[model samples]
Target chain A: MTSSHLVYLIALPLFSSAFLILMGRKADKWGHIFATLISAAVFGVGVSEFMAMHSRAGDMRAVTQHLFSWISVGTFQVDASLLLDQLSICFVLLISGVGTLIHIYSIAYMSHDKDRRRFFAYLNFFIAAMLLLVLGDSYLNLYVGWEGVGLASYLLIGFWNQKPTYATAAKKAFVANRVGDVGLSLAIMIAFAQFGSVTFDGVKAGVHGASPAALTALGAMLLLAAAGKSAQFPLQSWLGDAMAGPTPVSALIHAATMVTAGVYLITRSNFIFDGSSTARLLVVIVGGITLLFGALIGTAKDDIKKALAASTMSQIGYMILASGLGPVGYAIAIMHLLTHGFFKAGMFLGAGSVMHGMDDEVNMRRYGAIGKVMPITFATFGLGYLAIIGVPPFAGFYSKDKIIEIAFNAGGTKGIILGGATLLGAAITAFYMTRLMVMTFAGSKRWDDKAHPHESPVLMWLPMVVLAIGSVATGFLFNSGNSLVNWLAPVLNPNNVESGSELMKPIVVSSLALLAVILGVALAVTKYRTVPVEAPEDVSIFTKVARRDLLQDAFNETVLMRPGQILTAGLVKTDYFAIDGLVRLIGAVVSGTSTFLRRIQNGYVRSYALIMVIGALALIATIWVVTL
Target chain B: MDISNYLYLSAILFTIGAIGVVVRRNAIVVFMCVELMLNAANLAFVTFSRINGNLDGQVASFFTMVVAACEVVVGLAIIVTMYRSRRSASVDDASLLKR
Candidate 1:
């Protein structure tokens, strides 16, 4: 198949979403079915495209289809185009493939909602935007998709708008993303200013000639954008709150597609990051800090969706960190992103299944011994848990272990620090994920008398079962013999190959990672297997800090939001007392003069006649004086 | 009589009518005063026609009298409606337009 065939992958969902929206409530009866079929068809197109690309000759594997000239003015131009390249092909498959499963799952998950058609429409819209994001050939096109996804996410997150908090969460997510979008838009402007082009290939070609400072600025700005979209470091507070959206939204947009756009962007621009060591190190530092940041927060969250959201943050952190590792880490980042797409989407679906069974209660403390009640959810969630913790033979083991091994082999004191950070993150990840599983599914019943935990419908579990199998098998399939690495070699630099150290060999890194997982699991099982009645109030300061997301919210308020509020308040005062006061003064003068003059307009016809005669006499006298 | 004397007499009648219109509260008295001012203007026009040795001013007076008759028809209908609605013909009581 030619590159033109890639349009099907994007167009199917785009048209379906448009149709659903246009049809509105009239299509509510079968809108979800239409959405699911469209998503599945897109996945089918992605698979075909991937297969055709895989079968092509070297360098022929990449294809670009130019649709039209999007913008052109005096030596600057961009195209509305699509690219089916090695890097983007992976994103296409992950978005559409997992999107299909989530679409199916949402049919049952959102069955009771009166606006299920609208929900499916938003889901399809998200898929289309994500596809555009990955497939676009230029930064301008990517930004169009970027804002499109942001809009879709805002709509989905606030789908149940009757609740005020849900609306707040959606607004917060939108506002926070807009902050990062500024960074992206500025970076694109800089790209065009410096390189005279915003296309991926054009920018990549121009990076060699550009000054180091310009490249660093571009890279740093891109990192900011990524951090916002992927929920890294300072911008991450919105992701947990985003769980106020429907469970399917949390699964598809938050856990799977929308959040990983950051990694894809960074990796897509690997050439730039590969050029600037300072920028690359910044990416690594942000990722390293965020991984630990998310893991710490994950350990303290009691809400199931929030905890999972935290875990998603930490996982994306790992991918970002890997992308920052330079060219060697790009393939690893993409691999991890793909596998993460499978397992995380599965785990979130499992969480949704658990919520379905447990009357939509999200507090994990009130959950226990639900494994027997929801065997499929437990089984799928268990597999995903194993995959995430980097257990042997599972998906995360292959992908995440490669990243850990690369960090160790980075070869310096900085390398060791980053490596240790990655190792610590892995252990924390294992601990929290295990704690989640044990508290939720392993212990004695903690449910109240009114609770009736049972299995979700076949539609929900079927997707979970497919994803669970992928969670088990995808890592080994992608990583063994470096199949994904070789496939991505033409687009990404292949120089940063795995250079195992004598001290930190692959076996040694794998064993160490495994040991950390084992330790984390043992700690969680010992503490939470027989669940406690209530959390102890007098916990250590560190635990307290972690539980409150290390006061990240407070930090944001004091540092960012509070200052903004103060400035706004000052402006408002100025408007009220100064700007509006001027207007008020003019209005008062006019009204006061009118009030004095208004008595002359009293409805007495005789008074009006007298005034008219006196006015006529004065006019005649003035005319007589002037003539004289 | 001298035309100047007639003009002076007409001016005095018009002034009294104008004063009466300003001070009077009753609608009927205001209407009668307005008619007196119109008759004074008609007398001045007839005297001016005699002095100018032409009939233009007399014809104007005739047209004015026709217009006055039509005005009286419309004005009395409105006055009658006002009296029926408000139980009074005092112009002060017709100040609903003030609102």
Candidate 2:
């Protein structure tokens, strides 16, 4: 079905963003409210479209809207179009829905900020871009949205660019994302070369005729693009530093919507991954390595937001790993992504609320016993904590456990290794999250006497309450009746697992995950039951390394950044000496010749006449010699 | 007398006039040397007319004399203006165009 309403999903927020920014300080008082309403309106459109899709059946559920013919050449053609299928509807709702709530939350959160109007502008811009990312019909169309979000992310991350470090963090993110964009560009070129098309449907149809090598190359490049945007390993270093942005930016762009773009990309390219096991295995390996890599870093982080950043990385790793599992893993990865979006966004907002009450202090050690002072934040954050730890009746229990079960059921030594790694990740996630909760909420008060913690205003906690409710309900809602999977089946083309091919039963896997969670919580509770206000200077080497984000930045500097710096320096020297020097030499020769010839033009009339006579005589002499 | 002797006399007069123009510093002396060169050229034109048996060279000589009379008038006026402005008539003294 063709629906004209799809364009409004992106247009409203985009126009509002422009209006808010152009209006400047004059709209400061009501700009955030306007932005929030626009976001809510976009959500309203998304929900209405989703309902329209839901009322239909099977393949009829998806809708496309062609705005115009965007690119047309002799044989190449592309349309500026939108697709509101089951997959994209989920993202659209999450981006605009969570986005609206964040906008509301930011209304109160940034009331004191003089640049509140600009903040709303960036938020609206991001919502529009993220919507475009999901709703784009083809890889080329999606790349436009991809770059749009990267630009918005850079802008929002450096929203307070007066701080040099914050500016650096933003540059780091932009540069890293550019590296990944190169991968996306390469993937599109490969798609066009291999299939003569860049659209999802076209690529899917062409995958059968293409060679495995082509498919593998396309999949790997897509994974690189995903890793960069999704903050997967290697390219993952920028995300932690990205905490330098405001909390809402961290929650919205870093934690919830933007970071999951990788999982979305991989899932959208299911046919390519399904075509090549080598590409699929590489995905699993990156996902597995990052899951543990992030989880280990999470264990030692003292900053509340950085800890959440690490956890966000680890959770995205789960989604990436799930997407790698082929037909069985695709829909489950998205489900996990949706649920993680809610819980993680809620927790980040909760952290922001804590910061709001505590004078922007982020160290968890100074946050002991403040839960008593801030009840609503504590309750909302506690629910998110429960959801993330995969406790029963909460969101993560449903989504993350499914990923673990599927990892175990891949049915080989590979399955066992992946399964075990995910299990260990779950345990580590529980430990760190519990430690964060305990360090901030459960222990004796550690804040100084002057600090009087209080609950955030109603506007802030209202969104937290909404997301907390999502955290508690979305998992069960998505899991019951296998609804989410069935809804996405048409898009993902899920393959049914034969009965008894499973390595472990669902109940056994759930029980094992619960056991790991229990062990992790127990260890955290005992260790942090009585915490010191100051983090100990002397600690294990592992603790030290984890505290330093496992030296990912240092690793990047050595492997990528340092070498890049050297190459740049060499190029600069080459430009200065070779290119500039050549031009300078030419300039010097012309000026030297002019200077020597200029002296002959001394303004004496007698000398001028003497030269004219000599020249005339010389010319006559030459004519005479020629005649002879 | 051979018309070639008249050509030789014209060439010698032109060379001496050119030398005078180059060597003289006074503006009046330079102007007089320029007039002498013009007359020497007119003599050449008349000698060539006689030898070639055509009226073209003689007509050209008549035009040259007219042009020379105009040049003398303009040149004397410019030298008088320079002398009045600077209280000197040396061509070197009027070297304001020197680099």
DockQ for the candidates, in order? 0.54, 0.65
Binned by DockQ into CAPRI classes (incorrect, acceptable, medium, high), candidate 1 is: medium
RMSD of model 2, in Å? 3.3
Instruction: Give the per-residue lDDT of model 2 (tens digit) for A299-410.
Output: 9999999999999999999999999988989999999999999999999999999999999999998989988999999999999999999999899999999999999988
lDDT (Cα, tens digit) per residue for candidate 1, span A1-628? 2467877777889999999999989999999999999999999988988888888886888888888898888888888999889988888988888999999999999999999999999899999999999999999999999999999999989999889999999999999899889989999999999999999989999998999999999999999999999999878888988999998889889988899999988999988998899999999998999999999999988888999999999999999999999888898999999999999999999999999988889988899999988998999999999999999899999999988989987778878998899999999999999999988888888888899999999999999999999999999999778899988988886564555454477898899999999999898888776766577779899989988888988999999989999999999999999999999999999999999999899998999989977997799899999999
Instruction: Give model 2's TM-score versus the native structure.
Output: 0.90
Judge the docking of candidate 2 as incorrect, acceptable, medium or high. medium
Q: In terms of DockQ, which candidate is strongest?
A: 2
Query: DockQ score of candidate 1?
Result: 0.54
Off by over 4 Å in 1: A494-503, A583-628, B1-99
Off by over 4 Å in 2: A23-26, A494-501, A620-628, B1-14, B26-89
lDDT of 1: 0.91
